[model samples]
Target chain A: MSKEFIKGNEAIAEAAVRAGCRFFAGYPITPQNDIPEYLSKRLFEVGGNFIQGESEVASVNMVFGVAATGIRSMTSSSGPGLALKAEGISNLAGARVPSVVVNVARGGPAIGTILTAQQDYLSATKAPAPGGFKCFVLAPATVQEAADLVYEAFDIADKYRTPVYVLADGMTGNMMEVVELPPMRELSELPSKDDWRVNKLEQDGNFRSISSYSPTAEGLQEMNEASEAMYQQWDKEEQRWEAFMMDDAEYVVTGYGSSGRIAKSAVKELRAQGIKAGLIRPITLVPFPKDAFDQIDYGRIKEIFVAEMSIPAQYADDVRWATKSKLEIISVLTSGGVILETEAIVDAVKERV
Target chain B: MEKSLLIAGFGGQGIMLIGKMLGFAASKAGMNATFYPSYGAEQRGGTANCTVIIGDDEIGSPVSRRLDTLIAMNEPSFVRFVDRMKKGGVVIVNSSLVQSKVEDKDVKAFYIPANDLAQELGSVQVANIIVLGAYIAATGILDAEFAKQVIAEQLGRKPEMLELNMQAFDKGMAAVK
Candidate 1:
């Protein structure tokens, strides 16, 4: 129960280390450099390994190599860097390697800007890889939550035998807040890698190889079906979201990550002004808490506002897909690495209500 | 209750540090605080700013369009952010660099010769601390004694500069009264 003030990137890195991540590899990028920088010093202290890779492609491959040994490994990058790691991410997903990939996202299309932006939602949720494979995406609104989510991402990745993404924007990556870090986990507590890891081949005297390739068509179909099943299970068990002041909300504002935090503030202020505005924040962006959308009282809620720091409103599409009602889905957006202001959200809600 | 403050100045003015120190002290006092700096290329020598929010409960948004208070260390900062303060909010300015007067009638403005006071105290590098001390003195957002303690802890490695910083803080605090 000890609290300390720390930046989100540094907090996530510390949480990963405490969660028994023994190896880290990442290329330097704005807003996420602190993760590799902090781990370069911390992992060594914990008898772990760290590598400053030559490029994002090389760094993610390093993580893939580390994860193949059946140990917790991680890599981090921003939007442009994430684009570079796409091939490696696909390899991790295809090989069913349980590794953590952190994206402290900035504006994009192509190296847009280094400031805060939620532009990577589509890239992270829809297509993180070349194939149709998926990654578990966790979006944290605050630094404390970012640390907690990063700590939990390892277990989720291990359980499903897939890659997990801690999707944070530059604001969450760079902001400082008081966080109560989770206790350090013992190495012995980690799940045994005896069954699958390539290192165990020597002890078991069995031929085991980890690769993304499936030689036969039937084998590829089986792999895809297994991945689909894992995604289904995650949708059933790992869907996380928050509903604020929605009991009698007339207008429900929805967002995720940094945008959600700002939208919540606007909803609170709108309530103070006698307007019945509420918020639904999706914590897990991949299996996105669609149930939260279903629980909304459509009889009371007349409209839904999707607030995001992206002009195209990438997250709003998911909201639209989950929502069944014919209620208007309005988008309140700000792009180009600019943060969505509370006043703009409040004004948007006012206009609709 | 929740309070939000914006500290703005040139990149080398330690604007981010001031925001971090305030956030640290607020969190130490058992309040939830968040500090977000304006990042990117502007951090070299151009204008830099940060937003700090302190609340009794969990903070929702770290950035706000209208702030409770603003600390401006230069003319560009004052001109850029003065209109963003809420009505009746306090604006603390560095008189040595910012010559413009606060024009908003509803707002309360206090100008401190922070650079001059820090120079008189033997170092202009501590001008941000002087402005911070003045901010605490004028708004009473946090206890002056607690701020001094945080300052000492932050600068523990540089014991020689600690005394000078304290002197500058005291001088700035006195200037506000």
Candidate 2:
């Protein structure tokens, strides 16, 4: 298909449909309401189902229910809304259900602004719920990448028997750009779920019991170990990141999502001024892209600037863990729904240079 | 080449649409374009703005620290965003609504009576289109024909409005020329 002008949220919705997401359940939330709004009509055209549940909790549970049936299911929300889905997400994790959740995050500790923010990084990567479960988090800096990530998220979720989050901010959700959408997957071509799906119980006498809890401690331990195996496999295989202008770089700017995109511009401007700068943009927050940090020439690299839209520096903690305190890390931060400024980032680098 | 533009006005003044048109046209002309809109709780009559960046290469930031062009459709918008323009940038002020003069002498300013031209063309809603036309003529960053095609695609759903909008766009271009 040719490139078409589309908003990020809408592109993600369309991509999900093309990826054979036949069931969608999400409540309305600012910055991400466009996802449900687009799907409410678009899904019907493809003989799919879209439900705007009474609340975020209901919506997530609905997606979980659909996912258990071996159907591609998805739900999306902003920060506070995503918080409400946390318990349901944990339920999906415990049940070993494959689902896609989208968090078009906004600024917040609680009920904050309806503007863009990356405050949910720790929440999405570390612990989505209480049981120490993690979702494979994919962060997209551009609308095209956002669509591409959402399309791939369903596959990753199914492969890992885990939920995958297309982590985006309101800036990416609200922005419009030219995107070449993915081609539609035929329903027949979709992967069959006969083995694990809750089907064939009556005819084939193959009973499948799906539950998020196990009564015995040993059973729960077995489930935990099984999940750990999958996570470890992802740790070795799923780390995704981008290194821009890293060859012979003395300074590095590290960020994810929209902040990463803005940092790229700052790197360009700093390079124009004869400052050897590069960018380390993490595409997957869960795998954390630690190898990208390893690729950095610590001998020549000076300061590593971490740019984020959150003031408390939630993403910086991951960057710290990845770099292992090899170099001094400076931060360029914006809070309370403020977009990260390229000028602020450039000036921060200049001060260190 | 990359150009960053800011279009600001009241909420009902179609500020966002003009920005979308520019971005759509740029993309159709085989350039990379990103349109970042200011979405808030405010409804119509509240301040509205959007930023558009068009470039030949991958666009790093959707928002610009210093805009290459500013199309201010109101007095407050003109006052609020004039200083964000680069030294050699250009601004197209809707003179009918923005009564103020350009304070930044370094930037080129075109005071087009967008509302007057729209009213003359029979609809006050086309004022933003007039400003869009002026922007195309002033900057020449995008092809005028591509912009006109975008107008027809965006506003042409209602066939009767297409010709009038085309005229408003042309008048806007004429005002700048």
The number of the candidate with the highest DockQ is: 1
Q: How well does each candidate superpose onto the true structure, as a TM-score?
A: 0.98, 0.98
Q: After superposition, how far is residue A5 of candidate 1 from its true place, in Å?
A: 1.1
**Candidate 1 regions with alpha-carbon error over 4 angstroms:** A202-204, B43-45
- For model 1, residues A92-123, the per-residue Cα lDDT tens digits are 99899999999998987788998889999998
- State the displacement of the C-alpha of residue A30, model 2, in Å, after optimal TM-score superposition: 0.6
Model 2 residue runs over 4 Å out of place are A202-206
TM-score of chain A of 1: 0.98
User: Which 10 consecutive residues of model 1 chain A have the lowest summed lDDT?
Assistant: A198-207
| lDDT for each residue of candidate 1 in B142-171, tens digit (9 for 90 to 100) | 778878888899976777888888887788
Error of 2 at A288 (Å): 1.3
Q: List the residue pairs that clash in candidate 2.
A: none
Clash count, one per candidate: 0, 0
